[model samples]
Target chain A: MTSSAMQQLYQQIILDHAKSANGAVAELAALDADAATAASAAGVRLAQSHQVNTTCGDEITVRVGLSGTGADARIDEFAWRGAGCSISMASASVLNDTVRGTTVAESEAMLDLFREMLRSRGTIEPDEEVLGDAAAFAGVSKYPARVKCAMLPWVAFEAALLQLAEPA
Target chain B: MTFVAPPPAPARDPSDQTPSDHAQTDQPLTDRSGSDLTLSSDEVLRIRNDFPVLHQLVNGHPLAYLDSGATSQNPISVMEAEQEYYEQRNAAVHRGAHTLAFAATEVFEAARATVAAFVGAAENEIVWTSNATEGVNLVSYAFSNASLGLGGPAATRFRLGTGDEIVVTEMEHHSNLIPWQQLALRTGATLRFIPVRADGTLDMTAAGEILNPRTRLLAVTHASNVVGTINPIDDLVAMAHAVDALVFLDACQSAPHLALDLTALGVDFAVFSGHKMLGPTGIGVLYGKAELLAAMPPFLTGGSMITTVDMQGAEFLAPPQRFEAGTQRISQAIALASAVDYLSHTGMHRIRTREAELGRRLVEGVTAIPGVRLLGPGLGVERIGLAAVDVAGVHAHDVGQFLDEAGIAVRVGHHCAQPLHKKLGVTASTRASTYLYTTDDEVDRFLAVLAEVAPFFGVSR
Candidate 1:
């Protein structure tokens, strides 16, 4: 008999996302190269951060592109490529989809909300209306070891954002 | 607490006793023949009672531990030995005129002698280090010291420059590989490795081509921690010696399961961790040839290791003392000696035979499951009672989680051998390893849990 904890941790949605992955491997590689080039060009700001969970060798390179300036600054794209467990991969896929078109401030707010939920240890009920597809990861909070897996992509996203905010 | 003596031996005709029971008599345990080594199923069940940690419930089911490759659980006797040392003879060894110090030094030196005998080395040949990582680093740093012209004429043989090469195997854990890599980088020497074959064994053809006269040293693992493939060390040692290159063996995985004899193996240096051998952590053994250790420069300096100092230059002691700096893990060393005693009493041949049977069962059982790929030597090959496997579509971490939910514990990921995993065409793998205390039921539970992993993740065909 499977415990409710195990069922919650490996939800059907997380499994489905991990299987499909959504982004093509070749396309992700191409986007990585394109992001690197754009980050070096004038007037187009891009930030890329590679995060690794040394414990299990789970890794991700997240690239966030920003267009426009100041309050009007918008997240043009969020792209990532890596290999990990279902929770980590699903969390990355959901993070890319949720933060693609939001403004800089809105993306920061989402990151903060996700971090808070993960730190709750299953106590904070996930707000699906706010987290969208990412809300399925609430079960991950119950496991301390899996928390790093769910946060790998988001931590990379935050690092990229911080790089974008730094003055040249 | 009242102490209870073991029941008296039953009176019977000497010829009627089985060889397994005879092993417990006055004869040397190592003298038992190969046919006498195999344990009955009932013996394995009885052996499990010695390890208290094995009796527990994890999650909601009986705990099945299959991660002994990482660290084996200690039996009660080993723990008691350490606690007794702390309670009675706790004092700084090799210092002072007090009775406690003399007693402590006696116990410490006794441990060194026991560990030396365990691996077939002289007491002076064994050097204490914090762990296996430090043991490897000690030798690597000696090479660096020789490169800087630290030890006199005797150390010149170890010196390397731009053209020299250090050869290692792809199967080495990072502990063995990274030190050589850094040494190469620091000394302008090239770092090379013998490629691993598809079966996870070393490629001797590549080894022949790589181990030329320019090769200053060759380091390899006796058995791989990831794939569980025991390398052909005799041939490799011969190849290294033919080129006048020194050889070092990483015995971390093999020391716990195999009967080790460093002198017989003909390696210049070897290292193994205590924690992995059912002993306490923070203590490890490094065995070097007597002459080589006497000539090599020290890695760490200060305290008891030195002979005299006047702020200009200092003379260091010989061999073991020169290498061991600062206060050592005295209690851990005692515990490790007790662990060695336990293993010796059980007879290494018997333990090895039992583990081989368990390993065969694990390999056969896990491979029988659908969508499972075994990474090491095939079913019939002789290995060190361990298996690393990759599922068809499920990541290793996911498989590990699924197994954990079923109360099975295993090591998942590259297992500190990322290069070997890449060579095997896998990002990671789940490994199930066995020690003497492991039972057939635990091995079966591990396989049963693994059978559910693919289906649980909806990846089954």
Candidate 2:
């Protein structure tokens, strides 16, 4: 197939997300408190946010926080920014809602799960209990570049967890 | 996006007469096409056949070339000029005393004469460089060397130091921009730009403010690759001259498409790549005023460019030879001269006229398709033979992909003018450019293929 056939993938959902990618900023204080709470129960805190969708410039921010002993992470805030296709933003939005307040080890494990689920490389569905909002992005794995968009929030969540694990 | 193979270049039967033998076939010609747009089909075909690459296919598809802004297809005559040199009298020019060397040297110098004639400059003013990029870097690096106080008395003209300014346009390709930026950084000078207006024209009003007494040099593109806007160079040159600043022209986009006479333009230095002008890659021309080039120190030293050499030091060769230090792209240079001959034969004025007509047709056709917003000037006076457009709601990548599927090739993204792209309020754009080989049928087919873009992307009708 010629490079042009790749054009078929620019679905309407993508355009909508590109046209209106609001709600990028989030309340940092509230999300921070959630991180503190998650850390108390687990050894570390975790937060995730989507940065930018590389494909069409769509970006979402997901912040993960760990409250207690840095064992677990709690979803503090999920915000989106930029303009891009719908699948990426929708996927990030969904992923943010699903993985809040998970343990550090569990969050680490869930990263692979999320990646696999987003890619559809594995026959597993996202853990419904954990992947709540992120389920919309499960089909996004079909497009390789979009996977980065879907994974951005998750990566941010992991970063927040790592930050909590560091000695203050 | 899929990239179909570009058509295979037609095999040339070496028995054909060499280009030089037929160089005068279309001489005594001027800009007239000898027929109307639709009124002269034979004339158009004649012009088309002059470009050898157009006769081939890419991946079983006839090449629908729209990438002239990137590079143009060379004519057979250009190829023959390069090949015939090696086949007939191959020798190291100007370095050997034998007949072969003399003959080779004659052709080499004559090629320089041809180029000087083409650009409306004296033969002494034309300095051969690897390509336009090298030419820009040559000027930039020379300035840097001068700033270090190492170039002797000739260095005074380039002594840019603290509080000095080097002006460039925002529309410059990275090649023209970066070297100046680096030069400024090294010399404590300021790097400034003439801002682009909303209509894709240079903001001359802003340029007036930028070119003050502190300005030392001004570099600008003759034509924009992405938006296809020919710059207001007269105003820019005048502005820079007012401040005693030397002006450099990046003619990569304009030289092939327009009739350029560097002397008339009054720029201190002008640079263009051969590939973009229907010659082979790996060669370019840098034309500098004889006095200025003579004053500028050599950027590279050793080999062919040197004169009398002592154990402690060495004197350099004259102007052009001083700049071209190494063995040059001899064959490529020969081919480029031939390409110039081909353009001259077709009458650059006629080519430019035809392209202008096509630009008008392209603008009309592309605009008529709903949801396509053409960027830059809509008319010939402000625009050139290219069009950049945004298909409503569709990403540029997707647009390129769709076009590629239909055997149409166009450039996407910032086209290496990121600042201009940002100024235009677009992350990227889909650009369709044309040259001599572009035809009315190709334009019509392109428009037809583009009409399918919105529907294929499911963009709102």
Candidate 3:
């Protein structure tokens, strides 16, 4: 029998999400081109950030698309491409699914809550309504070495969002 | 080569034993008909008791330490050596006129002699550095200084310019590769590497073609930290010498396992870390031929390494002292000498034979499992007692986690040889390395745990 720790870390939902990440990555590539075309036609802005975990050489490039202006803006699209352990890939998949149609403020709020939970070291109980499928990652917070794996995608997401805030 | 099980007795005759005798044995110790020192299973079990760290449980299982390539566990004697130095005779070496200072200086210099003899080099030829990385950097910086005409007339041979070239191998750890890369960048010289073959060995054809007249220096690993394949140093050294180029060996992996004779190898320079050889950290050895070191400039400057200091300039000491500036890792050095003594007493020949047997067992067992790809030379090919493998459908980190839960500690990453991994078409791999203290049961446990990894991850054959 698999230990509870192993089962908790590699939950069935996380494995399912990771297996579907390839199709999501392909969709992200298609959206990259669409965002580039849409940016010129409308006032839409797109930005991408690439991050690498030096310890294991896992890498991710997160692309974020913003529509409308300032605080009223919403995340029109969210996508990523990378290869890593299940935690990192599943987190990227979850980020794409949860934040796509939400306002930029709502996405940022979710990101803040997610970061807090990861840093909680298994102390903070995750809110299922708030995190959606990402709540499955609460077990990852217990492993200090693997916390970075769960956070790599989110870190890349924040960098992409920062790029969207620039004047150009 | 036949399977020659060495005699049950310890290898060396106790009367003829000397520190340098371990590395100077010319006969291939594996000859089936001859008497060779090989540790029996019971002897290895006895040796395990020397290392206190090995007697522990992790995750409710007996700890199987197979990560000696990363850093070895210290024996009680090695730890006590350091502690004894601090307790009884702790003083700054090569300075002061007090009794403790004299005693400390004697102990420090004695350690140097012991380490030098272990590697078959003269006492004056070994220079102390913080670690192997720093040792490589020391030589690289000296070359940089020489390139700028810092060491004066004798250093001209070390100089490099636009037309000059530096050659390394794809299998080098970043410590060896990056320093040469930066050196080439700084001096406007071209940097090149000998490609790795499909079977994870060096392409000697490429090496011969690339090491031309313009090649000023050839830096390569004595044994690959990732692949565990020992290079043909004699052939490579001869090739480099034919073109009048200098050779530097990264001996971090080889020195601990092999009977290293730097003098016999005829390399211009070599470096090894203390921690990897059952010694303490914060101390490493850089072995340079006397003539080469005398010609090279100093890398660091401060107290205890100078002759005279004027307001305008400071005259420096020669060779080892010149490179070793400031206060040294005195206690660590004393402890490393103890480590050398420990290995010497156990006999390197016996250690090598036993490890070779374990290596064969590990390679055969790991390769037998479906979906597992061994990274280094194939079965029956000679390699250091280590194996790095990639699972078909699993990431290295996941495999590592699975093994850790079974109380088996192994290194899982690029093993600091990223270019080699990139060439092999893998992001990372799992490596299990053994030392003198590693036992048969440990190797068996590692193999058993590894077999379970794929099935646990639901990977198909």
Candidate 4:
């Protein structure tokens, strides 16, 4: 077997990010703690969303904290903890790195772009400047089944933001 | 990660297949299969060619179709039978008095007779349903009707009331589990289960305690889909019968791989899907003792099933037709009969012998890998041609992907038996299920690729 198609799904970059959430230790630590305990992270407004891919039993809980309010709000950081395949784990790490400290609007826009590129099935070219390490996932779009694994954390991030909007 | 990824490694020739490189097999996996390992590679290649789908390449590698436990591929003969039916006789069975209808009905009933003979049952004893799930629901609802006094004094023997009990095993697929659960819930009968041991085999000692005289029915699988354990059905049947409890054998997994004679098994009723064997989907069989079926109320009631009808009420027909209330799965049933003929011609004992060899190779090959943990019986134990394994630190989906990239199609996840997964202490597993067509080269390659998975992901023992 030529490992080209397989390698597309398991790029070295994905393997690197998947093995190490080194850049996102704070976020990982926050996700590991109880919500109430993690809530004590200064003045940041934190919200959490947990998602599971029922078919393969992959689970992820993403926590996004916003510092500013409404239209001007900024995503302070992101953290997550769960168990899944490398695509899912790497996607979570890459998403955490790409979206941290960006404006809430910008993060959501990036999420939309990543989602759109993945749904494009490699038709819409991924912009490296915009997607950063996430452009590697453009190849993931080829596999319709694995697309969900890549999107699991991004969906959780969106859910976390919407969860923050609720009348708590 | 804060650090940047290094350049991608040049693509390695995945075809440079390494033998089971690990010495874990020295622990008796490879050496133990003395005679079972004698399935000639030449014979397997011939069988593989019979399946057109098996000859194709998936992702640039030869396809090793190992998910037969999910659904077996149709052979050319089964396909021809279905196409012939559509080409020549496509009319509804038992409906119009036209020549086409007459021909279709005769052929359809002949198909019934073929399947009936296949399972050592009388032709009148087989009832058609959409699939095995529907088969379970049909009997459960028949009991529901009986409990409501729908079939009058005859169904009294089948009815359940307060304090009555329904029993199943912890290992049943949802098809068998849910219908009985709903039946118990509706009729106020208590639902109970016989649990499995830590090794995934049924605890027959516990089964003894759970199945008491109040047990009105005992539903169980002939073999477990998840663990591949060929259950001890005869002893269980005797236990259930000693107390006058009716038995429903789930033959979905066993029907295709094993030589099954449901009548000899002595279960009061049984269910198996046609698609799981070498046939088309949309057809399944429900076998019952003729007397039981005659006494029970029909689960579905409509045109073809009725003897006579009025505004007030209707008299249902007898046995098989009484249960088949809609337009029948005519072509599918006929194709299934052809599949049965194919299996019979090839010889079930021969198939069973071949599968036993493949089954051991699967168990041995899988268990010999370091981090890959085989789910069911270990080496030297009897199981069907399947093996489900849990890869430590690597999710089942990843194992599936790694195997998929190598052109090995397998089943991954909870496998619709979450309760059994819970008992096995894993959230999900990767299952490679073989059939009459699987070869040793495919089994060996699967093991080799599986060994690569943990190392590829930087997970080490």
The two-chain DockQ for each candidate, comma-separated, is 0.63, 0.19, 0.51, 0.49
Instruction: Report the lDDT tens digits of candidate 3 across residue range A1-168.
Output: 356677887788887777787325553453366667878477667888888999988888888878887778888867789878777888888888888888888888999999999999999899998798989989888887888988999899899888777465
Lowest summed lDDT over 10 consecutive residues: which window, candidate 3 chain B?
B1-10
- Candidate 2 C-alpha lDDT tens digits along B368-403: 989998877676555668898988877676676567
Model 4, B133: alpha-carbon shift in Å?
Answer: 1.0
Tens-digit lDDT track of model 4 for B282-311: 999999999999999988888799988999
Estimate candidate 3's alpha-carbon lDDT, on a 0 to 1 scale. Answer: 0.85
- Error of model 2, residue A103, in angstroms: 8.7
**Candidate 1 residue-wise lDDT, A1-168, digit = tens:** 556767889999888888776531434453455656766574567777889999889988887778888788888866788889888898888887788889988988999999889888999898999988888888888898999999999999999899878454
Off by over 4 Å in 4: A21-46, A166-168, B1-40
Q: 2 or 4, which is superior by lDDT?
A: 4
Give a tens-digit lDDT track for model 3, residues B145-190: 9999898998998898899999999999999999999999989999
Question: Model 1 clash pairs?
Answer: none
Query: Can you tell me the CAPRI class of model 3?
Result: medium
What lDDT is reached at residue B251 by model 2?
A: 92
- How many angstroms is residue B307 displaced in model 4 relative to the true structure, after the best TM-score fit? 1.1
Q: What does the TM-score come to for chain B in model 4? A: 0.91
Per-candidate alpha-carbon RMSD to the true structure: 4.8, 7.2, 6.9, 11.4
Model 3 / residue A102 / CA error / Å: 1.4
What lDDT is reached at residue B230 by model 3? 88
Best model number under TM-score: 1
